[model samples]
Target: MRYAVALAVAMAGLQAMPAQGAGQRETGLEETLAQRCDAAAASPFDRDRPSGVPGVPSHEIDPAIAIPACMAAVRAAPEVPRLWYQLARADLAARRFDEFRDMAARAEALGHAGGAHALGQSHEAGHHGARDLAAARRLYEKAADAGFAPAMVDLGVMLEDGTGGTADVAAANAWYLKAAEAGEVAAMNLLGDNLVAGNGIGRDAALGARWYRRAADKGDGFAMASLGLLLELGNGVPRNMKEANAWYRKSAVAGNRRGMRLLALNLETGNGLERDPRGAVSWYKRAIEAGDVMSMRLISFSYFNGTGVPKDPQEGLYWLRKAAEAGDPAAMVTLGLRYTAGSNVPLDFERGLGWLRKAAEQGEPRAEAALAVLGDAPPGRSACRSVLGDYHALDARYGALPARFSGTLPAFRAVCAGFPGLKEDDVRRCHLLNPDGAGDFVRRVRKQCR
Candidate 1:
């Protein structure tokens, strides 16, 4: 990231001259001293020397002067690995990629401890020149072998995806473990994922949750979202919708799109809490604004059905089109329905059939039924009726019954007798279908039965 200098300046005291016997000896000594000085100046690991008075000669000089002095110092004392590293770093800063590589190679050959890591990072980033993943990997491995945890993590990532060599999940896991033990936040997240997914290790959801919690507590947004999802799904922990909601809220507030979507669903459905349609709409809007495709689909559904807000067919069609363009199967189906019904638009059989065919190709049942109906009027009607029967059957199993029907005493009696798995939360959500207490007759039956 450092800016490269375009020009080099000679030191005021050291002038270029023809080398004779004695003169060459003096020049070599002066060059060696200059190289040593430059090396010392370039070392980031060392404390910087105090600045000298203006116009005064000192160990620390402007880089233009310091570079030549350091070259001279290296000429005089060529065995110093630190000096070689300094020269290499200087060349790197000056955007002299080839020279930096050569100097770094020399520094490494001289057994410089830190230069390898820097060289690896530079190559990995392509900072001073062209990217060389192979070279970066080699140097990273060397540094990791030298007990550098950062290098171990970087090497692990490279190996995990086969960036510079063959994929080695086991090796990647080992390196991640090493870095995690050394307190690397990124490595901890990777290790947790590996453990959770059973990659290069046995699946241990509990252990994964523990690690995710640790990283989440440390402000890792991905970890927070991961942990929240597990809690919501009752994976590796007792299902606690309240805790899941809390965590989702945390991540959503922190700009997590998934969290925003889930929170919206929970609010809309009154899952594990009081229902808040307005709150649901707000969260859905946020998720949609954040570019969550599913959220856009849900928003379109809401508008189409007049759920939680006034119906706006135009808005519904607009969002449906957006979601369909994003390749959402459900959106394609909805679009096909809109075109077929001529809702807020002209009825176009061809357009409707085209959209239906697209959805049917993706195995959408409604689309398939629509396509069958369009093919042969009578047979299609029969096929559609059969499909509708199947669809309603599936809906009864997974979806809530309408509140109006459930509010009838006889209907309530039938449901309570037939479906023992219905929870209070499910019943409460059903009430929201009417959004009014007009369904209180059903409550009377329950109270009388009790």
Candidate 2:
């Protein structure tokens, strides 16, 4: 939400004329930086290509080499804001806060868009002082208005998050669209997010897919993962788990945490790739190291099932508690079950019920079910105990145990007989077994036409 995106968006200042010899012959800081850029281009280890290219960089100069040359160039042309901008970049690379701040501010005062953007980055990051959202916004606005695409995206993020002012999702989306049109790849991904979520716009999955494609084509990792999710779910495209897995792998290689989690899931489930529990565990651990709580929950499941690592219910319980404590409602309900059933932990009714209540407060459906069934029941109600057992057993059959699954209400009435006011299809109830000794189908769905 900080209106300070990557500083690599500019270094040698805005495209200063062309990279030709005639343009470089002019005596100014731009020429000096231009020449330095050419030197960098000649090096196999360095690059300066910007926009819509994979495995390329935007302003990939050796800050160390550019530092001394930029310092001298600034000395020669103190009035040229671009020279001061380059000096500021060098100062930033060297961690020279006082000089960086001073030069960046001076360049901004002298009408340099990149300088304004640089100062915004510093303010947003609290590099030279305390974080200043207000200053960051003002500087970013100026730079964005001056046609800095990165600043436009940063400003949009701040507007959407309401960090610097009141949240205006519509305005935020507008800025994202602007930046996306201007070829800011990150903005393309963000614009897709806005479209999909209907944040300041009507929810349009096709439009979201379009923008995601644009960014993903540019090899943006976030866009790749997002598009993969859409493809996997058939949200705005066909369900193609194979293609989804490919994108997930690409995004993971690009270091996207969500990509790592998704790839781990595919590996765990053998959905589009060969099942590799150890590989799944490895990716989950990587995602956890990057602070993904969702991965923590999945990793707990691996431990519990002995799918990736050795089966260790104790370690599973440990991770479940950690995930629950970290605010995963599903894990919270699972933890509550652990305490309630004492299957993996001690049965402490009060504590277990308390955990369930907390999870229910967060709108976890399984927690609500637990409360409805056992809120007031102690260990001695034989009917309630039997019903709860049947409920869980059905879920286990359907592979969603501890998670709510649908059931036919008439079947429930036939089993729990005289249950009041229940007369509809139920996605909330578990499947019931036939009371008949023959074990034939009862109220379960018989066939699928499609």
Candidate 3:
């Protein structure tokens, strides 16, 4: 989620370059030094690694080891563009931005496609103190035209998003196709998304599925999850719950947070697997630990209803508050309602209104609607509005209530019983909006209310 320069975007440009001969150094010594640099800095996406040599991801490159080795290699073969680029990569990993700029510039001047791409990334990320999307795009084009698959993908993204120029969906698709044909997994995944969504590309779900499959086969966890969703919904593939569950499991195991949340939902509901509430909770916890905020909301529900765990209202409220604090608008609305209604909490109208106002500022429709009706009502009318707001929010989120919700209606009625100041108009409004469908109960309540 590093928006400045996404890891995939930065890594996509590290294409391998063949070593060019420098001065009159011995071939053996030059080869030896270049090999050392490659050992420390070869990218996993590099297309031309020596046999049996594994490529390293940028984040995994140890600057401590790579920097010194690449520097020595550059010293030995100053004319070798690859060595200079490798030194730049090591500097980038170490956050030595100025050093990276200098070395990468030198490497690009020496005809290294990866070095050009690196420069593009720096410009795009504002590492030069100001973002230059136009410069980034030009550099990406140069590298992409030179047959660097990662550069092709990055350039496609820029064109698709119109980051530095007019949007060109057709041009973006062409770049994606080129990169995908060259075996860029990120390109394959993005191509699948565009094709499926028909985002200025041809709508071909089956073809999109094929591209996703190819990327998933390359061990892309995000692609695995996308394929699973397609299979689950019969969008691009036939509905196959078992197959979908298998893919979801694979994606989750591979550390995709979306996959983890989806698999947990299926496990909890027995949608595509045997119901295992305990297992579902375990996965939800794992997702939360992985920084997924939605899972916090789900786990809160489990705690509230004692599903797979003891019913602990305080714990449930704790998770709900955590979610709200983390900027979940839905959680903020729910927390606001609970506080205003004094449901498992002390009545604090001002605190509840504050939460609602915060959510409304974020454009949460539910909070906006609730505030519209309840913001300045008198005590009795406010109590009535609180019940209505709580019911509406719940119905919007979950149409069918579980056994745990059975107490909610009775609790609502109790509020009405206590608020004798209720007007006939308030009771009529509640009856009209209530989904309980018990007109007789509403009539009887109307008769008894003050």
Candidate 4:
């Protein structure tokens, strides 16, 4: 009996030794799979690794390769938070927002701060779902508390803007300072903006310039453009047109639309460099291609005056319409006025009013006032209506002035008296309704009607 028991024990020990060896091999394979996923999907902005070491940009990651590798890694080590986070990043790169959200939630549950921040961003941006600002703010707060620099910066923006809750400028500044101290470039830019604007903080222009320079030195294009602005205007730094233009060129090369536009403006006006209308037009076109609506307007003006290109009113009109179509309220207002005045296009009251109504709906005070004036005029009074619309368009191009007192005063009153139901006092007041007075003017009109 003793021999039989010993033989059974020896067999069990031999079997356990092989099982241990198999377990070690499986562990090594799982690690290799996880590493493959990490290589494919890790973010350049990830704070998990050592500071200042950039990994792959999310856009550069090939989803086809990343997704399969990450899936295998996640399957191999389901309990590893880092693997789950990497898988989430892969899904996000593929624009599989729903899957990314789920995977990010899993990684966040497993205590990955990057996963929490990414999840918060998804909620904030309303990716593949409704925006849940409260949920986003909560997630950002959690990750920020965990010492995540990106989360700290995002949370600061939310608090300052009151996106998910009441505005807390002090708290927002605190978070920005924290992230900035931790070497977050975006936070540095925000800090610079706040200091320059003195928004809920004491003015510190010199300090703001320093903050902008710090981030600009780190290859942040937005900061480079901002610092350039300060230098150009001599706001916080000594006026240095050469340095400012150099920074603007650097920022433009780095793909900043504002930088491109600014560089174009400088070339056109000879502000910081010799006037080069052709170069200005080229830069403006580049900015337009980069999705800058304002550049569209500027380029349209260039085409209208033959500044660099040949005089082409039709091309100018086309660009104006493009800007208006892209939802630029200023462009809509300009196009609406031009249509009313028959400046570029044939006189079309309906089309003009339609454009003005769109701009008014977006809270453009100029559009609202123009609409009010035209609305009171009878359809039969086309000549009177044209004069009113033309004067307003001129005001929009230049700046607003008192309607009863401007160059159009004689015609303005004559038209006011011609309208059957229109009150001259109300018409004049409409012209006075600048952006700051728009709300009060609306309230008074509403009260009068009541």
Candidate 5:
């Protein structure tokens, strides 16, 4: 899963300002235009536009016309900070970092915080330059002090992470509260997260859900995703899978990867939506493209079982190992078992145990069982004792062998052939599609087969 920012650090973006320009003019000509646009056309600056850029959202603007129009407007009003800021926004969106910096600096020097905020975002993300968290925090502070709500959210993140200075949880929550009070949707989401975790605020899931709903109403994808989680888990709210799926759909539509993942998983299982393997795969692919590494492992499992795609063990192992190496703990556990059992490759106990160690270090409780096979203790025994309930669930689900797990059927029969009261198939389906039940069968071998 992506970091919340606990997760991803993206705070908020700059909203368009109402001011157009101060009405000044400059000379220069058609040679200055970058990207695709005609110099003769006027910039599309509409004062009445309530949201987005002057007249249209960035996505609606024709790239062939945007840069040229903004350049013409800047030339027509050289000293206008608003015009410079607009061009800077356009430049930054177009990935023209040098031009963006120059224009944004000019607008910032003229006392416009929008340009400064954009520049600070670039610094925070280290776009087209070295990462400089200190510089980013300072720039964000400048913009926030100038009454920029988005900057307040960004500053709070830096403070929370100690990016520019000492980690100050209370101060971070304060900034988030300030921006939320000012009606910044992203700030509301951050503040809600803090409250839910009691990081710097009181732990209150009800209050957190309220804040999430408020931001969701304002069309914030992160907030929508958070609200969906609360609704789905009944955390300070009644469990309503249908409502949760609706919110997940909204969040996914708004480009939230976490939402896309959950919606995809739900679609696959018919949890709240109709089971549509193809649709699930589509959403999974989208989330994967958006940098959701965990999706790789899930998609790989689908491939292995031919649940949502063609059964291709080679391709499945490829993706599974890739994700595991990328530090996905569940993937690591699966890969560990694969190596240990020589499922698709030669058996390599040492290497398999090494994979388990990596997953264990990452606090994957599941990895502890496989680690125990190597006689590694303290950590293993403690991990097992801590997750006794999980082990119970594992045993209850896979204590007996099912016909579907044909690959491990021989081993299961040999070990549990005469064992009484172990017959079960109702919960055996889990063994068919997932690696989670591997431990239950393995424990039987270590005990009876020996």
Candidate 6:
């Protein structure tokens, strides 16, 4: 995650130079800070490496070497928080969980507070050998208490999810606010979502947009997606399809799956850009491979319609089945239709009814209508609840959303232009409006364009 990387880079800043000796030695803290800033400004993605590596290594290196260098540096200067933090990185990469924990402990003992926070992350990631969420929580709490920005986010996530603890939306919001105040970009996005959704916070679309923009500016992909959605739908900001597309493109280039899917749609339909079905297909494939259910559904549709790729009934059916199995309501409805029509698969009333029931339970109006046509009552509403449970299961296996943004216009523009049938007037009307209204608008756009 970008949040983790940014925190690591921040800690590295504190390690760039050795501290002063007791009496005569000069403290190079300021010089170290300047050097770190210069390096970060030059290339934010570059990871710090050992001096032993030749040829000015420009990219991230293997954790094995980096950890040792950090450990050696810490041995030479135990009080340096950066060295401890760097060592932890190496240990995490090398899968030396116990060592990382021990090193983090040592760093904390030596007054390197950030080390404690990094240690918590390692625990959460099950670095080294074993999973230990309790240990991670303890370390997260310790780091949060020590005023570390990332720790606040980490603690907030844990509380929000009730992972390794009880769910506490209030506590989560407090931690998110603290992290936001400390300039943690991901926390800003999370806080924005909470504000917009009225989850443990009063609804505030404008404030939500503001927070999303802050994270988007910092190159957070999800934030870019959220901001683009807001702008495109006119929620808390002026409706601007061009701006929305630009943000989507920005997020897509940064490896956001939803952005890629949206961008693909734009390419296929020429919403704000020139139509390019081949390019759209490429983007859609990428998103599908990354486990976006909507992408899967779109891919199936494309196959069925012979839009970008050659028409293949089998392929269409396969993708539709994949989406349905993954709990996509539209996919379930489509499958039901296919069964009812005896198209692409055998005509079986029992199977058709089963799929229709699944879709209807999830509140698919089409499925409900089809059931009515078949002289059957709509399935139980409990199916709607099951949809959310299924969504969580899928999200856990595949990442939920894009995690970073590139902050480029081409990227953003793609997302804005991708969703079809989005009128300029509709976009303008949703800006800075009520959250419920904004959400409804987004749903309308998604349903129509998708």
Give the top-scoring candidate (TM-score). Answer: 3
Candidate 3 lDDT tens digits, 302-402: 78768778898798889878988999787787778778878666778788888889989999866776676557657765546555545644533332123
| Candidate 6 RMSD computed on C-alpha atoms after optimal superposition onto the true structure | 12.7
What is the C-alpha lDDT profile of model 2 across 87-122, one tens digit per residue? 676667667777878878987888888789889988
Q: Under the 3 Å rule for N, CA and C atoms, how many clashes does model 4 have?
A: 0
Q: TM-score for all predictions?
A: 0.52, 0.72, 0.75, 0.75, 0.71, 0.66
Better of 2 and 3 by lDDT: 3
lDDT of 6 by residue, 113-198 (tens): 56777777777877666778888888888878877777888999999988878889889999999989877787998999998898
Relative to the true structure, candidate 1 reaches a TM of 0.52
lDDT of 6 at 122: 71
Q: Residues 127-203, candidate 4, lDDT per residue (tens digit)?
A: 86689999999999999999888899999999999999889988998899899988889899999999999977788
Task: Name the candidate, 1 or 4, with the larger TM-score value.
Answer: 4
Candidate 4 structure lDDT: 0.77
TM-score of 2: 0.72
By descending lDDT, how would the candidates be arranged?
Answer: 4, 3, 2, 5, 6, 1
- Which candidate leads in lDDT? 4
Prediction RMSDs, each to the true structure: 11.8, 8.7, 8.6, 11.7, 10.8, 12.7
Q: Rank the candidates by TM-score, best first.
A: 3, 4, 2, 5, 6, 1
Candidate achieving higher lDDT, 4 or 5: 4
Quantify all predictions' global Cα lDDT against the true fold: 0.64, 0.68, 0.76, 0.77, 0.66, 0.65
Which residue runs does candidate 2 get wrong by more than 4 Å? 1-30, 37-69, 87-100, 127-130, 349-375, 381-450
Consecutive 10-residue window with the lowest summed lDDT within model 4? 396-405
Q: Which stretches of candidate 4 lie over 4 Å from their true place?
A: 1-23, 44-47, 50-54, 126-129, 349-450
